[model samples]
Target chain A: MSGRSHDIPEEVQVLAGEYVLGALDEAEMLAVRRRAAADPELAAAIAAWERRLAPLADAVPPVAPPDELWARIAAAVAPVPQEAAERPPLHAPAEPLVPWARPVRPPPRRIWPWQLATAASLALAAGLAAFALLPRPVPPVEMAALTPPDAAAPGFLVTARPDGSVVLTAAAPAPVPAGRDMELWVLPKGASAPASLGVLPASGMRMVLPTPPAPGTQIMVSLEPKGGSPTGKPTGPVLYAGTFGALSP
Target chain B: MADARTADEPTALLRQVAAGDRVAFRRLYDLQAPRLYAVALRITRQGPLAADAVHDAFLQVWRNAGRFDAARGPAEAWLLGLVRYRALDIARRGGREVSADDLDLPEPADDGPDALEVLAGSRDAAALHACLRQLEAERRRLVLLAFVDGLSHSEVAERVGMPLGTVKSWIRRSLQSLRLCLEGAA
Candidate 1:
């Protein structure tokens, strides 16, 4: 047999320890991350060390972050309703409120989290409070009310325009199975098969269409795998259907 | 089993999130963000930076939840690992500002056996406690400083007044021993 062995090199294990211990410098840390990607033994060692040191976290006391922090994180993760995002941020700094006062300071070298959190939080809140006063976006050109197969009440409301822009709001979302996704499809009149739009967001809104489905097209939604269907077509049960119509508010 | 349960619930929630389940993502966020924010706060020592780290980490969680492998490690460790790395990245980039004197030094009793004992709430925690206790007091103290305080090896060396090389070797050996200890070697 060749001289290969199963044990992770002692150097690899030590680096893994240092990586999990938060002791590696940036270069070393990046090197370790890169190496672990191609080295299963090294990856396993790193995971093991992370488990060993996980308990150390119990010592640090938790600090409640700014309430606005959640909104920021949620906005980062979910697709922000495009219409809400497009409206000009209520006010421009036509005049600097305080030319000297920066809402978020560039972190000082000797930064302190509690004090900085307080200052940044106040600035954020003031900015949001002001921004909330701005007017809402112009309403969509058309609306489609999605109805479920056997239900009388509409299940969703889709607001869209001729530009292929859409905002689908689920009035009542079904329980999506853990491994499945909800997909949107559109069938313009004279098209033999429905064309795929994309996967629907589990809640809130999902935007689809590069070009608005031709006017008078029928839109349907179905459940599929988490990444949407592999065949570029819906392969699961059709859940809801709605037809586009002119509606302006 | 308790430790696995501690991680499995989040793993399941993340799975749902990978499938684009916003409700599950929010549930997972509620479950982990406090500690994550606190961890980032300690490491970055800037609230805005901490918030950035948490924001970036959860964004990755939402985007990459599909890749989490439960068999490779616990979900809590994976989630914390993401934030820890991001916070460390931020701290490293702001290296010019991180003066040694500015560190929030660990309290004298934090690494004490009693304090560590209180951490024995999960199987990994219990095993870690047993292994950590076997290290000589100084190395145990150093490990706590490096991990809990998020100190670099040089920073730990400077704080402990040891040569940088000496600190590195001692910590490496300490980690090696701890790994062996948890593997049931006496």
Candidate 2:
């Protein structure tokens, strides 16, 4: 269906709103889902609705869950095969059925953002060093860096860095439908609105925003239509969001 | 009863969970599970189903703990989102739907004007409770059905024995009114 120029249709907005409120029926919900996949405008509207009505979920009081529930779930989604195989045997009791009798111990510390960023930098430097020792071919000058959220693996990179300018280089390729683009978002601390950096390619291509965002700010990428976010702020699930720790001179 | 430590916030506990701290996850579960379970029970109505939903939700918490982004919303909202989605998914699967008769919640104590006065001890929570009291009986029922029972429009209509259209409009208007009432109280 054809959409109006420069504005989302009122009916679409209402539908999106209801969908966010969980008021729509199963059929209506499916229709919204299909449209959201194809239409960026509808997706943005639905995201806005999700944010507004999210607070209502907090109105209900909490209840404690049964003990066996967590264990059942843990058994289902355990990451490693060896871990999964070892789980039941580890938990199976030899004598008494009193599972709560065993003393509990804490798990290991998680990988912090700083640690992940440092690791990525080291890996990048190592790769560059390997390249430097091998070929005499001229290296590309301008580079753009795409860092994922702290502690997350670097999903993409930027190759063309010119003083303040940068280009997005996809580390791992992502699928993008025709006529759609990935818009970058710069979310500063204490700022509600995410600033649009520019549109990026699904694979890897070059597009530069006004300039690199302020240091220590979170850089995010969300899928948007050709021109970018109409609302001037992100209205999509953050695909890649990370901070800029240091820029190479 | 273990004295709940107020020093560590939910975010801190979540961070610990992200680091693979199972004990911290258990502590976090203890701190927040009661309210989340209450929500699930209210929505699912059947105790076992609610328990199942809560179980899945916390397991999601454990597995996807690393995905917790503090910038989007609070730890409680994130956790509650998981529960709300799970409860709705269960309701959609046609396990057991909450009926209005199933939701015969005790009427707020009618201490007349002194109700608000007595609630002053916990002003914020009291304000919310008072505003909830201000809603018309039917509207309050609708809110409870939507928030607790996780009933969609048609389900609410079925429970209340009202026309689906009427139930939908009532819920929308009631939510708007409640938002205004709570804002005014604040």
Candidate 3:
């Protein structure tokens, strides 16, 4: 065997360290990122250096970010609920008014059709809030009643219209505590992540969907930070849920 | 470094996050974001930029949680790495407002245990501490300034009042030495 082995050149090793150290300039940084994606040798070197220097983070003191920062992050990732698209922007920017609520996860069980009338009161109660935002009512093409798994009474009602909008009405001024916002989510059957429907207002609000939800899609309500679930899904306990079946004309 | 349990919990969370579990994603974020924010703050030295960096990093994590490979490193390190790179990108693009004159080395003694002392005590990081201690003090500080403070090569030179070439060579030599030492210790 030859005395010399094919070791990574010293130049590449140092370059990896420089990249990991955050010592590379903009052009070099971008170049490294691009190259690392396709270059296994370079990628391995970068990963190794990252592992080596990661402990240095312990040396930097942890600083708590301002509360609004999380809200912005959540809002960024949360899907633009179709309802939000049609509604005019709030006159003043809505400052998160409440502290983050403790998140409640949804039970594994599914929603049943028997609970429809049980939640009709919630839809009726939300009509006042809905009327204020939506000038006139278009007949709903599809509807789902959101009810907490633990309770027999439905807490909210959702309806889809031919115009591809979804409306949510609350049973009463949903005992939403201060500092919390109730956000809506939809988990299509067989999917892993739920998409944000948008934050529900005090009574009821109308939203336009980018496309009508498919049958067997589950609509849910989750307690979240003021803006929404920062991670783009349900971060809080799922308060209620109902399923949409085959579209009815 | 965190204990095995503490470290493993985030790894498990990342796995769940990869599987599209939002609860795990939020739990992971809650556990990691503060530290990540601080790391970004040190690099950018600007609140808004740091927040932006943290924000972008979390979004990437949400989108690419599947990329995390537990066999390679701890989840915390992987997370810190993501924010650090993002902060550096933002800091560079935004143009660092803090000049070299105002740059302060980490305080020797502050509210808690000294950072270096804490580093020394960490089981996973002890070898790194030992390896770092082997370097000359100036070289050691250069590595920390570059890695923790997110200084670029030119910026490190400006901060230490060294020429750009000398700073580059010193950093390269220091890294090589540290790498050799770490590998030997490992």
Model 1 lDDT at residue A10: 76
CA lDDT scores, all candidates in order = 0.67, 0.54, 0.69
User: A1-249 in candidate 3: lDDT tens per residue?
Assistant: 011112667787888999999899999999998998998777878878888888878887778864434434443444444666577633322223211111233223223111222232233223322332343543334677788878667887777643334666666435888898988776655555665656777676665332344456688888998877776667899888888853344
lDDT of 3 by residue, B1-186 (tens): 566677679999999988877667767877888999988978876554576678778888888899999877788889988899888986776434533223333432322235567698777889898898888888888888888778899988997899999999889999999988888877
Native contact recovery (fnat) for each candidate is: 0.63, 0.31, 0.66
Model 3 ranges off by over 4 Å? A1-6, A82-249, B1-4, B98-115
The weakest ten consecutive residues by lDDT in model 1 chain B span B95-104
Off by over 4 Å in 1: A1-6, A80-249, B1-7, B95-115, B121-123
Better of 1 and 3 by TM-score: 1
Candidate 1 clash pair list: A109-B97, A164-A212
Error of 1 at A23 (Å): 1.1
The CA lDDT at A88 in model 1 is 62
Best by TM-score: 1
Ranked candidates, highest TM-score first: 1, 3, 2
lDDT of 1 by residue, B37-75 (tens): 888877876565676678779889989999988876778
DockQ ranking, best first: 3, 1, 2
lDDT of 3: 0.69
Better of 2 and 3 by lDDT: 3
lDDT of 1 by residue, A2-104 (tens): 0221266878778889999989888988999898999888888888777667777876667776555554555344444587667663223223221111112
